[model samples]
Target chain A: MNLIGISINHRTSSLELREALHLNRDEIVSLIPLLKEQIFSEGVVISTCNRTEILGFPQTEGLDVNSIIGSLLQAKPIDGIKPEYFTRFFSCGAVKHLFSVASGIDSMVIGDSQILGQVKEAFEISEDLDFAGSISRRIFDTAIKVGKRAIKETTIGEGAVTVSYASVQVVEKIFANLEKKSALVIGAGESGELAAIHLRDKGVGKITISNRTIERAEKLAEKVHGEIVPFQFLKEHLHNFDIIISATSSNELIIHADEIKTAMKKRKGTPVVLMDIAVPRDIDPDVRKIDNVFYHDMDSLKIIVDQNMQKRKEQIPLVEKIVMEELVGFFNWYNTLDVVPTIKSIRSFFEEIRLDELEKIKNKVSDEDFTKIEDMTRRMVGRLLHNPTVKLRGFAESGANIKEVLTNTLILKELFNLEDFPTNGKSDAEENHNSEGNDEKN
Target chain B: MSQTITTLNVLLPLLYLTSFTVYLYDFFKEQKAVGNVNRIILFITIIVHVSYLLALTVEYDHPPITTKFEIFSIIACSIAFSYFILELLTDIRGTGAFIILFSVVFQVISSIFIGPNYKVPEVLRNRLLGLHVISALLGYSGIIISAVYGVLFWLLYRNLKENKFGLIFNRLPSLEILEKLSYYAAVIGFILLTLAIVIGIIWLPKAFPDFSYFDPKLTGTLFVWLVYGVGITSKWIANLYGKKFIIFSLIGFIVAIASLIVTNSLARTFHSFY
Candidate 1:
């Protein structure tokens, strides 16, 4: 029950320290087993670019954090590594932190979404290494579910929160299917190349890169696997493109209103997206006035980025609510694990007494009477045990303090005068008896 | 049966109101829990509405197309049913809230004023007349749908032009899709209206004996059909589209609505069989 973890994330330590202390796949593969051998019954290591966390369910309460840190440092040592750099969390806190990390809310970029897959990989690695305890497996399973539910049910991962991505979002908003569309990049500078890459990634069918210099344009076109169009024919080819992204160093507008108007005439009311994500503006702002031409300059894209970021921020509480719901579900199952054995024992105790009494009366009654007696005694035991069993399970699943549940379970055991059992929820006598019964049946 | 019709008349509008509210909730909140159930509510509402129409038909001994109020209820059901089909075909449910709101208004008006019209002409009970009226009602539903998409297209176009980047821009279908739907719906409306007019022409003389070609219903139907016909032809022949085509569709819808009101309520016409 002693779930614990330490996180060295972007918020806790410097980038240099994190890089130096980060564990790769091999290090994690070795470290999890080492942690299991030294202090923990189960362990997992989540190592991503933004964070490296080592979580475990310790076998004893007297474990040393310094020894755990030393084990990690041994795998990938760094100078001046200290315990203060790692933020520690106990049972509930560790669970919540893992859930948030999986949900992508705790990443350096809010809603990065890639962290969920990484979390899954981390869990799978631990599972494959046989470092997974029953409790740890449940925890990791719930974390993955929480991550998926957050994405499916909320807008946390929606919209574009960066400038380069905002241009793509604008185009998506204007066009229903990008696979049938074409894009023309007017400049081959960094921003223009980035925009073209985003467009290509978004499945814009054909990307044609046009630039003032042929070599730079050819390089970008090659990178995006696109065609290269001469810069001089940009306006003439505009009519063929569904999207025109212009980013350049030109102080004046590279595209004029008349050129766009001519393009619109040829497009026959088919809409076009004109993205000008460059400083000092590249496409004419007057293009906005033309019908069926959707235009967004750098300032507008920034506005969209801001709005999307704000929208993501608003979804924080919703994602947190999902995490808490899943966390409660996990704890409910965890707490019930304790009460399950007790419930089984109570049923077994009453059944043994009922069967013993039935045997004593077996010779004194007719066959029909004996069958009736057996049925009556069985019903009596079931009726007598139903309420207590139901209440005990309700208490366990109520998500109250585990200590309270354990105390109630202990009291029930004492009141019943049941034989002492192991904390693993099974006794040696029960195991021996069940095996003998199975052998006889075989 | 009359009691059942009365009860349904009261329940029909409430059901539509509930469906509209669910759709509106999904539109603004965009919550998965609500969005997933939006169509279920619409489906249930459509079923209940069809049942209501059946009850009216049983009670009155004719299809629920004898009076303007009954026809209004029929139109309400038609719009909801058509939108459901469109949603299924295109997998576009984002505009359901706006589309279902029209059904709510029409159903509410019909539910408030609907009653048995026992004096309906014998000609109204003819199955041909029923088909003609039902086709005309469905045609009007298409016009309304086209107009709705046109207005949405205009709103989104303005938002993109002015760089609003607000909720409407984010939620509405793209301009091209809206325009395409609008144009498509207009085509459907023109074809259905043409069927209604042809049926009317076939049955008019047999029923009226002295029926005039200048009957307000006939002339009104011709006018609405001509408007949509011209709009569709312009698109095919002159490649007319976008804002110009949307404007044309809206104008056609307005004329259709105006003509309906005039021919039904203002002018003297044998079309009002009751």
Candidate 2:
């Protein structure tokens, strides 16, 4: 079996190209059968917002990369993009890439945890379509294990790697508990919505959303289970909130230093965290210097995000070590698969020769002598074949190079004149047939 | 029995020291596995502590409250017991290091100062008095823990207000949780202290006809009770909370500690049996 992968990620492609090539759940499901027929025996398609990877095990060697890419592009065609934009990996590299991707190291946001779930969903889809067989199953399962291990054993997935999540983390650092804290989200934009959602997820007791338009604020509030506040009342009620996240599209500053100072005066020294996660910032920068007012703009949040990213990057070697260990385990088990059929073929070839010799000698002797002779020959065959069988198993268990084992297997087969042996070795069937023939003959 | 008590005396302190170290390690390292290990160590320490107290009771042929050393041992056990229950209920292991360190200190002090064969006074031999003393010790344990929580809350609140996002900020529970914990512990302390004082008052004349109502320990007890009473009542009725309540609880505990020390040192009260 030959594992193969083709990927187009944030590092290799532009956002437009990635979007053009992106596959949804339905698209991925439709592509599964085509991928199997056009490229490999088993296939899995992992398509997330940041990356799209088609990983499979080819049924045969010398499969054309261009042809596989052509098939994929044909299934989901994008204009003006060549197959060269996608990066390809062969067997070991393919497996390692999948493991790394599942572990979130290859994600756009290095330690974002969403990629693991995406990978699982992709694998489940492949499983539902019967496109993933035992090898794919083992690979996906091992990838998931590596993902969980990377999260559990190391700090790769520890901190928030996004600005929105970092804002919530800042609140967590300041307040230590969000259960009793209230948050106000200004401007109903994506970043503001994300911040509010994160605060809600962290169990912040109350959340209010305010936008220039009350309808938009109400919509976002409904989504985050927060109450809608009119934009005019935002500054007036700022003292009531412990955390304030502002992400508006307005060019001018929405919250000025004077208003914040007034709010602080009313807060009676209770600290308030203000996160301005917007371009051209929604809050005045001078407000950060105010006492009892913890103000962080996008740059400050970016510093936290960058620090978290750096921390996760430092854990790459550790995660890579874990992945390498898991790879060795998988390869060892896979090497055993390559040797098992060869071992069986050798055993059956010897068994057939012994049975043919026994048949020739059966009628040449008296009944009692024939019985004793047959028993003796059977014991001799067993003893003679035992050492080579044990040695072959030892070679397999020792995790020797698969190519060397296959070469040795070929030499053994040639030396035994077993060239006519079945390519798909039906060893179990032959063993059963031999035993039944022996019983009838006796 | 005496040999077993001796063995327990050494074993319990060593166990408590190990628990203290584990909790400290967990506090700094912040690993889930280390936290789990700390929990198990603390649990084992508590079990051994209870066993030691049982061995002491067996050796003395009564509850082990006859000597200052025995009372200290009970105090140490009560602190650990209350902390263990809090940990179980809150699943907050960050405060374990501080609480367990205090327990170790108390156990060490008890072991060093309270000898194995101290004499019991005639006035303290009454079972009711023993109950009162044990109840008061447990109550003091509750108050002490509440005071620690109060201190942590103030430290956290101050750090947040100052934007000092340091170790204490990350490790301790949130301000609201700490405040609630302090309030709960203070309530428990208050109820137990009430029980101790009431029992003391009802049995005061029966035990000692010459016992004065104005004795230092009794008067000190009443004063601490009134302080905690005012604190709790203010929190409930007058919306006194946050830093105000935290400061009140800490002051109340400090007064209680002062009462204990002054009454013991001055020997102007019959309650100072040691």
Candidate 3:
């Protein structure tokens, strides 16, 4: 309940201010220690191209927004970034924001997967700096899990959003085990280079680049860890590649249907994917009529990308539901942290009465009988306190209004006169039953 | 034993229906939790179907291939069993409901009208003859499954080509994998059909002196076998694959079902033994 977060994300600031406010690794390392020294008991600094957030538990009664910014400025001074540019979140707001950010719902490119990795790396940095406590670790770990669950339970991250990536995705739909497949990117233009890079990132076994100028082809091939083939020999070598992407400026068709037909003959009916990303259309569209050839021009790839983007947009509600579920689970654990101490106090109050009463009957019976009476009274007190203890913990971890739970805790403390009872001795009843109570909550 | 067989005969269709329902739900709704439940239900149904067939064989004193309806039930069980194995091996569950629906229909027809033939001929009760019929039924089951996958492949291929992006396109596996599975099923069918034909060629003449090689059932089966043989051979040599190969496999399946219908209902053949 003592959490607070300071964020200068894309939503709250201009690109110029965000750039100035962004903290690198060395900057975050220096700033975290200062923030810990001045204000936070525990904290994590998440800095990425889109956002830089500092989430922490405040050490004192008053949280000064300026002091936190001052600490940041001390670590890495910015020219004109003002305190008004940073948005602040408190308590449940902070927790919800963290979950949404990790789940990619709050991303600039909604469902940008890199944000989840950035969140995890921030947590690791906090842990490495000994700034992450148990509570901080649990919250961050829960955020990571929420991110994963969102991806697994919804289609938010499915398909390709970029044109070059869409070309690779089309090939993937027709082929499995990309590591066993080969690729050929013709022309070595910017689009062709991007296509080759995407294919290489997908672990395609071999990539061959062909261009009119050998110098550009060699440069791109080396960058993608691929081989270069002379542009004139592309027709003869088409059968060796399972995927072919053409992106060139030529107005004339660089790849013809007859050449592809010849390749399919020697390839023995194996499937081939051809992506023509050029503005003027490099590969012949008629190649799609071949038996095992799947051909896609830029228009088709754009349609696929647009459809995928729409699908991701439709999945926002599902991802938000996942974030809500994880937030509730996190609050259950967070609320239990408050309830455990109160539970211990209530048990101590009851044990005090039971032991005091047992002493009154200590001398009225034989030693064996006294032992039996003591055992019976202990069981009686345990059974009497069991339901209330469980109910109290349940009310706390139920993720209801925090004020309501706190009021109930106050009423229990006042009703039992638990404040007068010392919280040290004869509290064995709680430890025995607390695990069962917590297990039921979980 | 007859009582157990009767109970199982009634229960088998219901189990197949349940498996198909759950699988259909999983395919449409994409519920992973329910998908697991569907597989377990399917596994139990297959086990129960096997038990039913065993009980029927024990009670009737021969394999459950004596009548056309009985063979329908056997083919139903074989299809379900083969599809279950394919689902397990490939980890592809989208096509399971479509495949299992065939089992549900066949088993329902079997449960409604099929009964034990007490007057089956002694020659039909031979173990070698039982093997031949069972193998033939299994081969037909494989062909049926291959045909189903081929249909799915064609549907998905059309969806992709037209850029429809509908539920069928989203749910079905990739075109390449579907084509591979269809080809694999065809190969399995061709092998099993060859075994059945070889067994029949060795045993049929010695058992029946008047057995005619030109019997309607014999010629029909030979035609079905030769169609698949040619299809498989063309795939290897002539590079007939992809959508073309799938179309060919589907034609072979249609020819097979036509042969079954003609030999059973239209023609007077030597296979009628009851």
* TM-score of every candidate's chain A: 0.78, 0.83, 0.78
Angstrom error of the Cα, residue B17, model 1: value is 1.8
> For model 3, how does the per-residue alpha-carbon lDDT over A1-442 read when each residue is reduced to its tens digit?
7899988889988888878778888888888889889989899999888888989999997888678778878887888888888889988899899999999888877788899999999999899898988778778989999899988888788778888998887776678689999999998888999999999999999999999999999999999999999998878899998999999999999999999999988897788988999999999899988877888888888987888888889889998888888888887867766566677788777788888988898888899999998889878877887788788778877867778888887888888877875545533324433454443332
Pairs in steric clash, model 1: none
Q: What residue pairs clash in candidate 3, if any at all?
A: none
Ordered by TM-score, highest first, the candidates read 3, 2, 1
- Name the DockQ score for candidate 3: 0.37
Tell me the TM-score of chain B in each candidate.
0.97, 0.96, 0.97
Which digits, one per residue and each the tens of the lDDT, describe model 2 over residues B103-187?
A: 8888988887766654556666588977897788888888999999999988887775554556786678777778888998999
Write down the TM-score for model 1. Answer: 0.81
Q: What ranges in model 1 sit over 4 Å off?
A: A13-42, A57-85, A124-135, A186-202, A210-225, A230-233, A247-252, A329-442, B264-274
Order the candidate numbers by DockQ, best to worst: 1, 3, 2
Alpha-carbon shift of residue A282 in model 3 (angstroms): 3.7
**Can you write out model 1's per-residue Cα lDDT over A169-211, one digit (the tens) per residue?**
8788777789999999988988888898999899999999999
Worst 10 residues of 2 chain A by lDDT: A433-442
Displacement of the residue A27 alpha carbon in candidate 2, Å? 6.4
Residue-wise lDDT of candidate 2 within A328-411, one digit each (tens)?
877765665655555556666877887898899888889999889878877777777677766665575567677787887778
